[model samples]
Target: MGYYQIDCFKIHLTILRILGVWPTENPSPCYIYLSGLFVFIFTVLYVVIYTMNFYFLPQQLEIFAEELIFYFTNVGALSKALAFIFLRDKVKKMLEMLESDMFQSDNPEEIKLIQKAKEKSSFYWKITAGLSVSANTVNVFLPFVVHVVFNVKLEFPVCRYSFIPEQYEAIFLYPAYLYQSIGITSHMLYNVNIDTFLLGVMFLAMAQLDILDRKLRKVTDVCVHTNAPSGSIDKMIDDENAVAEIIKCIKHYDAVSEYCKLIQEAFSEILFVLFSSGSCKICMCLFRFTMPAETKYFVFLTLYTVVMTLQVMVPCWFGSRLIEKSSQITFSVYDCDWTPRCRRFKSNLRLLVERANRPITIRGGKMFLLSLATFTAIMNSSYSFFTLLRHMQSR
Candidate 1:
């Protein structure tokens, strides 16, 4: 049971709950009520601020550019929130399936394979989580630090709108700052948790593929050496056992296939939104970085660009690995000693090869394939946009 445990994902869920993006598993009445109330309040404030920024902000290029960045930041948050709220049940079901499949194995070899996969997955999750937290912390607190050190009064408006009344500015300033801070941070957490969880699932899929690859090779070896045994009876028994092992491998492969499909279904839209917003964010951040700006904002923009780039890269990296691992299944089947297997076993092998040839991929909204190639394309497009913006700014 201890070996079957998945603790890293649990820690992620805890962070989600703490950030108010996810409700408890069995929330009490008061907890549910308060959580609902808070979400509603947060949503309302977010909409008001977003609407104000979009419609009422001045036409100055610098202000408008800053507002656009803010708009997309909130857009990322809102999309993440909506995805979690709508897709949480699907995500939960996926997790349940993952846990059941990954932890139920009793074979020592299989267990070791599973443990290795889990370790790799945990490493990826921790690194991504740490980077996300560090980025958010700096982005959130840099203004205050700059204000203190430079002796400049920093205006921390959720969105820059011209509507705040002078008479109420003094009274509402602190409260407004507090409200915006909470709203933004919660939204940021939603982004972090959803992405991290999605990555966790991807990593697990990779682990499953690794195990499947090993099992596949072992089955092939057993089949290939069927003639090594001296007696006819021994050969027959070995053949029977090899067939059974192949059947088991087929079932394992099927389970992994289904798990990959579930992940695709659950996170496709979320990944789509992330890619779309991320591209825009990168372009804008890069543009802002190239323009003349204060030291504080320049640093913020640089960090923002890095964070956005990582957000896109994480999925692409994992998704590409998934594709690579899955594609190996066909080759693993071919590498086995299939020459000695019976008709039925060969038939199953052929089917496995056919299926594996199709390649398991994580698509963004079922549109763009999430792969290293896609990541490269995104980077190229962002740079192109940045170049175009620079040209216009120069003019």
Candidate 2:
């Protein structure tokens, strides 16, 4: 019986693998899945939230905005505090090293210092990497929690009678609202996490730059002062076999920094979009309470189109600019002077630049997908809203 049970287990494992039910070795595929989920959630949330603000308590939009602000601010503070505790010492050391004299050779003493700095920097960023993972995990689960907790409802009866009201068609809206609220909340939280991760990545690149700059300055000083044999710096510089490596490192630093800046710009732009949307929601609420129902829905539809378009188009626009910058960098590197000794280095630099400029196919590709999703969701939701309003009008 035991032998049979073991054989059954092996069979089950084989079946799972054959069916592609086993966990993937690569995490990129996993992240791509998450990103898809994220985009879907955001689209749904925009529809739900905007519709609720328009169709329901349009006057309470300001209050909702305030609540959102509090939630995002708290999350940001928590993430920043966690990052500081993990990275304080490493950040201080990197800053100190950057401030120090640049002619430090790869002597035993300098090597020890670089090793320590690198270790500390790595430790700090590892914390951020963990937080990035954690934040998304929390976002994934929070919607389920909120759905259970809020028991949010969007449908309430409006008086349908001319003399005495009859029940108009009941539209169930709370589930949609719940999903929207959760999606927006998750997005805000995710932005905070992205900002923290960008900071950590930038610091890591800075640490690498500091170490390399110090080593290069030391080599230049030595070459000036002493008639050293060829490949002298190769012995002294850690992994300094060719100029290609240095260019590669520099290119990597540029990539990291550029990504960080893009995140920053994207964050700010998204926030502006959210703020404007929120404000419009508040205005719609005020108008609805005081104005007619039909008029309120009209304004809501207009605002929805504007907000959704901005969200989709702004990112696509920025991503296009990034592709342009990356392309320019390719030519910039190719134009650099190459010494005979730096031939391998030049080739490597060219390779790095080419990779950076390769049209940003994968990451930038998502923008188009995002645009499609946004457009479809907005058009569909608007149609549904208008259809319902028309039905109410006919009755």
> Number of backbone collisions per candidate, in order?
0, 5
lDDT of each: 0.75, 0.40
In model 2, residue pairs whose N, Cα or C atoms come closer than 3 Å (at least 3 residues apart or on different chains), thus clashing, are 45-180, 58-285, 59-285, 161-165, 244-345
Tens-digit lDDT string for candidate 1 (1-395): 44253565777788776655578688888877776677767765676667775666676777777777767767777777767767778777777777775335766776677677667667776776677667656655776678779966667645754577769876776677667767777776777677777777777777778778888887855544445654577666667777888888878888887878888788778778888878888888877776678897887777778878888997898788889999989888776777776677788888788888988887888887989899888889888988998888889
TM-score per candidate: 0.89, 0.32
Q: What ranges in model 1 sit over 4 Å off?
A: 2-5, 101-103, 138-152, 220-233, 387-395
